[model samples]
Target: MTFRSPFAIPRQLLTGTTSLGGRSAISTRLRCNQRGLATVVPPVTQDATGSKGPTAMVFMNMGGPSTTDEVEDFLSRLFADGDLIPLGRLQSYLGPLIARRRTSKIQKQYADIGGGSPIRKWSEYQCAEMCKLLDKMSPETAPHKPYVAFRYAAPLTETMYEQLFADGFGKGKGGRAVAFTQYPQYSCSTTGSSLNELWKWRNRLEGKRANGGSEPAGTIQWSVIDRWPSHSGLVEAFAQNIEAQLKTYPEEKRDEVVLLFSAHSLPMSVVNRGDPYPAEVAATVHAVMQRLRFKNPYRLCWQSQVGPSAWLGAQTSDTVQEYVKRGQTDLILVPIAFTSDHIETLYELDQEVIHEANNPGVKRAESLNGNPVFIQALADIAHDHLQKGELCSRQMTLRCQGCTSERCLGQKKFFAGQEQASMVI
Candidate 1:
């Protein structure tokens, strides 16, 4: 019966563990810990009073649909970010307009999944499942501290912090926090956004007279696994989910069916800007493809495009149409964009794209809902990170080299002070 903030971000705490390996460029250059694998996070130590702060986890995500007459207003805020969106000025006027126009359709789609999105509900489930799995997978830390912070929606960064503060949770016992991101992959937009928000929140907190955040409360000891796209257990979970979903399909048609892997669309601009989201999707798609016993080949596509700017690849809508034209009656759409079935998966795949190229065979593969395998994978990934100590290896961040984003709490700083001086004013 506890209510928490919708906004949650990752806090970088000094990991007490070591990082290992030097394979992927992302992992090699910037690991959760620069040294080696194997982090040593001290078990949660309880104190004298009745207040024992819990170990917390926050999932940084592109949140589900906002339930507001002002849903358009929410969309505008997303598209209006000067750094993320190319059309900031236009977004001020056009964002809400476009979002409002699409509201009914989107709203109806949400209705299909119930009155609201299943993200928070699923996340909470996953949290409980994660705890269960952790208890089984890593008995040493039987019940880890975890929390969810949605980027948008009612629970926001400001609100989560308020709850945390009121709960007697002040970064660690005295002043440190072992923060984690649920996503196994690290991309500028995904991992990066989470990191950025954390910094912003920390800075915002530092500015408040109520909580002087300047001093190290528990060093925001940052340990993030980033993205576990390559994790074998997770890949296996996908294989299992895909297998279970295909149950309704005729066994012989499995080969005939096309596996469409659809991820949330990112701006090609992020790639241009050095965010590795596309690569992350590529890795997930490839890994899943390898794991599936697909007699039928698959295609990797992107969907749910926002903003007026050019996005990364073939839109899911177009893909659907093309698949229909190609005479493929059966198709399975896999949304690896999110681990669970949220608004994007519900509305975009279930509603918008479903109608695009209506075919008798089109169906979306279920997202990773607390399925036992997938849930187990979550714990395995966490265990792996704990084994490796640090979540990522550090590489030189050009943005952070000389940047001065006081509120930017990322270990890999993106803005050099020199670059922001002109913008800071």
Candidate 2:
């Protein structure tokens, strides 16, 4: 599948700069414009006495459409991502066709969920709030700027990269930026694809020197918070939400209410590739269960498996149906993997599964959207990463056991080597 940029660059931005792989020259200009453009665009960094920041905290995720009108484009982009869907050699040909075919159905789903996904609203609010807390928690990284890089919607990775350049990041005046994945657990199809796209843009916009040396001096240095499946703050947030949901049950039946932790399912193809998602997701469930002291019976189930391919399951919908049929109708579904409300939770879980079960006792736990605890956890994670000064988690340096993609290898190497690169400067 091919990821084509939906936004175009003005001709002026392409004046005098190198292009990578004959792609475009605009990206290079965005970096090297320091020579003449620095005068017009003031740097975002602080003066000698202030905090060492204006740090960019970019949140990455697989975004959904914000409105019904955007559903088609969103699905088209999603289906076109080989990293996420992997449609083989005809990926380019089949992706758009499949997207067009499914657009109407998906659009209706989004319409039923209040005309669109609340992901963008929640994501923006969460990131902005997290940045506010970071400014107080980590003075060294104060003036934290929040940027959302959505894989399949508006404010795409390319757009975010351009904004960074426009905001005085990489025009030869080096600064720091952190790519924080919104997903609690890492998966090649999700976090990995986002990082790969980020890496691609970094190379295009901040490519090697015209003389074929290293990257230009003062280009933005990057670090990553790749994954944090079982962070204490995260577990606490989930446990609290589950407890609150449980309180709704009758006093006598509270303990009998089943806690079903649901995460997006992966294609078995991906799972067999040794993707770390399933295991990490389970880690999060275990951590939250321990925090709750396992007061209620619980199980992990997968949801949102698209297409006909074999997917990892105990499919959430099926599980809910079976349990309710067996008279275990007091089930509280916890969207464990998603950070905010989207079509999956709003439409699938709420509108479809629970609605079909036709039982008022069957309900869903609240998402982490705008949850103070979850937002605090975000700040804590960022603060720790900034203080530790690691390029990325040690786990990020390793690839899946069955991986063979050159893109994955290169992306890993670039991020993993940032420690030495940052040190050299």
Candidate 3:
């Protein structure tokens, strides 16, 4: 059962395609590229003996609860993170209090959207499709097996690591593992936290081995997909999806339609500390707008600001109301920061903000969940890492440089070492 806005207008009206003669934005944009979308990708060659052991691509993200009962637990775990809350000594005491207070309200919101977040389902599907694409792209390497590791919920990062070790992943023998951060934009709080948990598990395993525990299979050489906010395949996916949504609007009003790009908000405190999230999110919007050739006037906004310590702004809901006040009735919301449909897109944007705005034209574009182009983008990233034998992007050989954030810096150095070791072999 899916949850759609009860106040949502008819399909045609919502799409802005009345009986008025108007060309669908999708048809107009995609007419030339009907065969397949063009993307900037590195050449993939069929080279055997790339790596010896099985290749594991583990996708990591901030997970949601699978059921209503898990809501409080999810919130508690999320709030308990010092990276997210940053309450220091007060966090252990206040995290549970905050989660307890917010649980019921958040639970109701989740119920409004079919009783749970569909993030895991969509994430798993994306991973599965990416595996297929990776196999096709790099026939020389062992077929990639996809795994999901959530930071704060079931199938947690530790659980996934244990499973991989049990299955002989990372047990040397030339086994290669890729920790792909699902967050296209890098942030100290999100990707940083997930990777830290992952390495902690690795260190624990080494400790066990040192203490006379039986050594498992071979050691696994690990790489990472740190950030790809503006990868060509990813940009194409967003542009195509936005154009498709725009086709629903009346052709005459399409030129005046406003594209509102909303991303999850981080506290200004985080930004003051030099967290790169806001800048990276803006880069994504800039890239997508460039891809669309700036067809529509757009604004980048923030959503889901929690715990109210002066998060990023102007807030999405307030922006919607302000646009209406300015006689801008035709608006389309693009969740630029989020890759899949979840509470932020489903409830916060769809149900609360749009519903409260009371404007029929203020509709939302769907998230890029399991889009084939996006899957290809992910596969391309992994294939590049495997071929180069380094954790890097097409944009850079080392994406994080001169970085003060300990986790980000450490991970980059670790991958740089891996690249050096590969050269020695």
lDDT of each: 0.56, 0.80, 0.70
Instruction: Name the TM-score of candidate 1.
Output: 0.74
Model 1: per-residue Cα lDDT over 1-425, one tens digit each: 00011111112211112111111111111111122342332345545354323344554554565353434444444443434443434445543444455566555655666766666566656755676566656654444654555554434445555444443445443422334455555555555555666556655654322232244444233444456676787788777777877887888777777888887666775666566567767888788877775456888887766534577778777887877887886888888767788666765677667755566578887778767788777777766655555534332233432334453333343221222223321
> Residue 77's C-alpha lDDT in candidate 2?
78
Highest lDDT, which number? Answer: 2
- Pick the TM-score winner: 2
Candidate 1 at 293: error in angstroms?
Answer: 5.0
Q: What does candidate 2's lDDT look like per residue over 1-425, in tens digits?
A: 11011211122222222111111212321211212232222347533466568799999999988798998788777767878777666656665666676677777777777888878777777887898899989977777887888888766888888778877788787788999999989999999999998998898779844333356787888899999999999999999999999999889999989999999888899999999999999999999999999888999999876655688998898999899889999999999999999877887788888888899999999998888999999999999999998888878877898999888987887887744432221
CA RMSD for every model? 12.4, 8.7, 12.7
Q: Give TM-scores for every candidate, taking all chains together and pairing residue i with residue i.
A: 0.74, 0.87, 0.81
lDDT tens digits by residue: candidate 3, 90-177:
5566666666777877788889889988887777778767877788787666666667888776667766665566555554533667
lDDT of 3: 0.70
Instruction: Order candidates by TM-score, high to low.
Output: 2, 3, 1
Model 3 residue 359 lDDT? Answer: 83
The local lDDT score (0 to 100) that residue 319 gets in candidate 3 is 90
Candidate 2 Cα lDDT to native: 0.80
